[model samples]
Target: MEGPAGEKVPSDNQVKTFERTATGLVREISAFRTLVLDLMFTSPVFMFVFAILGIGIFVGADMVVSTLLALLIGFTTAGMYALLSIAYPRSGGDYIFISRILSPPLGFMVNFVFTIVNISVIGTEAVWVSTMALGPMFSGLGAIMNSSSLASYASVFSQPVYIFIIGAVVMLVFTSVMFFGTGPTFKIKSVLFFVAVFSVIVYIAAIGLTSTSAMISNFNHLSSTSYQQYSGIVTSNGLPEKFEVVPTL
Candidate 1:
């Protein structure tokens, strides 16, 4: 298309360049799906659930008040996520949101804080994973070597040194992976994502079935004893005045 004043208009080449850029963006977005799934699988949800269960067990409440507290906190966190998404609706996340809400200086400061927190979280995760990986090896070392003299000296020297070495190794590996860029990182993460999901499903199924079976056996024994005591066949300690039936799903 040309203007009537003999001036050259935007040509097909310019249009083609814009289209190519758009196509590249679409391809990148499509490729990111696996990375997103990987993140979802390795998320904090599992740790959060385990923490809540541990708290409930340790608190020893008949009705588990910690469960309610967890629910409330979860709801509030979800609401915050929703609010942030609605407000920003962009890729850069809180940095963009803060910039929109306040001055650039404030936004940069908030972004710096977010970066620090994110790095700290990454460091913590690396430490936790290293602990899980090396705990068995350290325990084995302790068992083979008596703790009286040699083992004690070994433990004292090895603990901090091993931890430091592990931390350094983890950091180096992660840094190398990151430096390689998103493509290779995403590929490895995709495999880890599937592994994490499969592990969780297997763990949950095993624990759930075992717990249910144990509960059913205990319930049957309790019911039989209650029946015997009610019929005046034998004396039972702490018999309920009235039997209450609880439904299990």
Candidate 2:
């Protein structure tokens, strides 16, 4: 019986089916793909490069201690998210949980702000890809090929217009992949993930074989930027010539 607006509301017995039978998306993403997606998001290369960039800012901070603390916190937070996912099987993500626990408006507001923040960070991340990944790749190739022009272009990632174009191209590529739909997107991501993994392996092998002096020499040769200049930056920042614990974070 309905009396509020003289309109009838369906009882549990009367409401047996939904207006729409399908929930729009088919769950084509496998467990492996899900893990791949997460790994791509948490790629250590990006984190390492970002930390390296922030070294001057965190000069006084203990590198080992900071790294350990970050790992501890990150793991704990991930564990909590995992537990929550297991508890709330079908429903997921920050927004879903927040909306359920708190008010939807508050959840929406928080998620919306975070969405904007993530979108804004896209350009920076793209620039990082240009500088950290492509620049390094080009430098390594230059050293191998003995091409000065190739080496010169290694530093091109720093140019404002070049970096902007790199960022824009990266955005466009990803957006185009998204337009192809989720299944194709994950497939493409999987390919990219393996390529990144291989690159990481090569990087680790190269680092293991090469000395610090050699790395510096290569950098100087490629970019025509002196190691002395970088050292000067540290010195001018009031950092000691020899730091007991060099902070990367």
Best candidate (score: lDDT): 2
lDDT of 1 by residue, 174-194 (tens): 689967877777776767677
- What's model 2's lDDT at 239? 77
* lDDT of each candidate versus the true structure: 0.57, 0.77
Summarize candidate 2's per-residue lDDT along 1-249 as a digit string, tens digits: 686999767776784422323456536578999999999988866655655655556766655467677898899889988977876665577777677778788889999999998898887788877777778878878887998888788889768888889989999999898988888999999998999898888867987999999989877875555888977876897876654454534
Against the hidden true structure, what lDDT does model 1 obtain?
Answer: 0.57
Q: How far out, in Å, is residue 189 in model 1?
A: 1.4
Please, what is the TM-score per model?
Answer: 0.55, 0.75
Cα deviation at 237, candidate 2, in Å, is: 5.6
- Model 1 alpha-carbon drift over 4 Å, by segment: 1-27, 31-42, 45-58, 61-72, 79-91, 136-158, 212-249
Model 1, residue 210: C-alpha shift (Å): 1.3
